[model samples]
Target: MNLSKYLLIGLGVLSLHSCDDFLGNKPKGYTIPEKFEDYSKLLNSSYLMSSSNTVLAYLTDDLYRTSRGEIMNENAEGKLIEYTEFNFSGCDDHERNLYTFKHGQVLTAGNSDPLWNNAYENIYVYNAVANNILNVPDATKEQREAKYAEALVGRAFEYLNLVNIFGNHYDPKTAGTDYGVPILLSEVVGDGASYVRNTVAEVYDQIISDLKTATPLLPEVATNVYHPSQTIGYAFQARMFLYMGDYENALKNANEALKLNDELLDMKPYTTTYSTFGRIVLESNPDETFPEDVDNVENIFMRNLNGAGSGFYTAVVASEDLLETFKRHLAPDGVDMRLRLFFATDEANFTMNPSATPEKFKGYSTYAPYITQNAGFTTPEIYLIAAECEARIGSVSRALQLLDQLRDARIKNNVHYVEETDAPNRTEALRLVIDERRREFAMQGAPRLIDLKRLNREDWFRKDIVHSADGETWTLPANDLRYIMPIPQTVLDFNPDMPQYDR
Candidate 1:
């Protein structure tokens, strides 16, 4: 297959004017797909498998921004030149706006948010397959149904991210009335067509409906992680149900997904001593040791962080709070494979710049130069989901057992890893599970922000977030309206009548 041809097809469908302009635009240079093979090729396109809303990581507490003045030095010419310190110097205005929770300021009318645009663009690909695959000539019933199921699951994954990022946290009381993202199911959009936002409840309902309809039609395991399988379908259901506070279904689906694939990557083998650092470090290069996102045993479904030009995945370092979490969760032997493998604190090895100062190494550097940060479903996430839901609806011991299983895999030289058994109540058990989630998934995706939004519903779990940069501090109070991100000004400009969030 000519991958470039499909790339052009995907790019041709994108329009800079607006959501409608992009969705309505047809492929100009390629032949319109008319057969099952062509549609299958569309589904198989690498463009649809990768890319996710990576900026969502900025809104979380996992990262801290460095001020320009902190990293700049005066040269012989008396001009200030910025030095790279773990790439934090590359943090841009949009990232700063998100980091500081500057509402209505992250984007301007002419500027487009990659999170919003990439999601909708991928949705167009999925919709194209879902809406027309059955009608394609020269395909068997099973093949058509299977391809259609894959598209539905793919589309649901995109909508799940869109609704969570743009809509408010799900509330049974207000979800039906709260505005969610616009739902576009048709493959082709009419000229000048406009779409009204769907309610949060309606959006969730559609997601659940699609997953339910697609699960049985999908294979037990996908040919690869890029394609959605029955396992991925169940995993997504588990995730969606957890967000909705339906612990029963969350636990049920988590178990179902785990039954299909529960393999976790053991991090101990990836650890080694670097002569330059004089201490343990993860493999100097991940490509040699760590599996690519598509081949990772832990991945149930693969969607990589769209880190190109976005520093969130590669440039951003761990915040003090996140570093503290790693320290707090270290095994009795003072070994946490996650911290050692995913982060670097040795200034010389971390930054690879001799000029880097000790002050610059206050926060650990993210060692993700080659390892792709997956924002999609993974086996360990399933374990965490099962643990959390079990803590809420089942025995606390059962929850700890599940949590211990995952920790044992990640921690080095662990005998049993049953440290959480002392919890006297379900509340303590749930707290442990939540902390484990932060440690395991820190700086990866939108999980932390989503956790904060949902857990704020409970008074016990509710807490404020404080971020400091350039001698100024901003606090986002629990349940603050700013938890919901504002729609990009470009999006609103395109559809003047579209309802916008007040945040």
Candidate 2:
């Protein structure tokens, strides 16, 4: 039941596979999980896999500069550097050294940064669990199958993220030609072998295949939000389908997830409080620390970041544009519950050592476990996707209804539902939906960037996205190759044939 027990057992399982943790330590002998329950515990351990995606926010448009009195500390500056130029596609063309990195070179910790390394490591761990759990001697057939299903779901989610981040955006025309990430299905046992990149289509097929296989095996409910359930699997499918531009399947999966659990957190209660961030963790009580209190009706599956210290949650100060946009749409009063509750009035203030009273509007960081920040895949996301789907199929009224459902919950006093009249036609309705989507998922980071990548392919959603800080501006045009990150140089060095995405 304890995490420590699972940690040792997890490490023991990992040792058997000759896997390396983030800490570069010599391999040691340990026992494999003989019981299915032990493998279940291993799955629960944060150390066993990558907990949350902290780095995706950096690649997003949600971040902006905050002018402050004190000089930024080294850590803050480092983050700013990486935030500006880590995309690797346009760094060479950019002004001002384009952040601390050279063009075409990715930020690295051993091989790549934590996001890349942790993700692959997570894949390795999931592979270990899936390949071994059902064979455990102490479990019944049904229980073993259920645990095995969990592994597949876990593996599927990571691969879904991996392919999207490293591979080019899903294009029927080019996915076959586009390079995807290195697919690591099982633990690497031999002296390290070279890996050629999989095509984007192949990787997508694998992700879909895993999700399809795993969904049927999952229970209706999970032990916790961290664990995947049938509903979570459906949610994952909805997201994948949405990404693939398959509006019909996206709608189907989203509705299925809603049938399982549909709840929306009222934003009214949080009007005067902060949401979550981890920049300054100085607090008298552990409970009062980062991630104040964000458990709400909307969250479908809530796995967050598992790293420490001013983690990805605190990376970006909320941009003024997002705040202004929220104010403009939420009400004429220009004071939304989202703005009041989550963002600080003096957001631009940057102190070297922030005060202990951090509950004060800590920007868009959700009040999550200080150890982790929730990368949301909440029910509202489904609502948004459904709205988008409806808008796509010429259901303007239906799309607005969906937006109102979410808007009514977020806007204070329940008066500000987005109306169909605001966008009378399907094209206009889709535009409204796109705007709402950006506002809804502003601080979360992944969706806006993802939306940009996919939506930009169309002439309608094609607007230049500008990311700026300290007088430097990086303007991304529609469907830029920079959207697709370069595969690591180490990956290229190992397999020379594994072509990098366009620089």
Top lDDT hit: 1
lDDT of 1 by residue, 1-503 (tens): 11112222112345212222222354432234667876777777666766655566777778776655555655669887664654434667777777777766487445777777787777777777787788877889988999999989988998988888889988889999999988878555554556688989988988988888898899876778888888987899999999999999999999999998989887776764322232333366533555667767998888877763324434666777887777664656857788776665533343445444433343345544346667889999999999999889987878888887888888876554343555678888888888899998777657898999999889769888877766787888888778777777666655778887777
TM-score of 1: 0.86
Clashing pairs in 1: none
Candidate 1 weakest ten by summed lDDT: 1-10
Q: Give candidate 1 regions above 4 Å deviation.
A: 1-31, 68-89, 272-288, 308-310, 348-369, 415-421
Candidate 2 wrong stretches, greater than 4 Å: 1-32, 48-52, 66-102, 108-111, 273-295, 306-315, 347-372, 416-420
In angstroms, the error of model 2 at 13 is: 14
| lDDT, residue 193, model 2 | 54
lDDT of 2 by residue, 186-290 (tens): 553343455667898888898888888888888777776777778988889999999998999999898888888778765544323233443323234433333
Judged by lDDT against the true structure, how good is candidate 1?
A: 0.73
Best by TM-score: 1
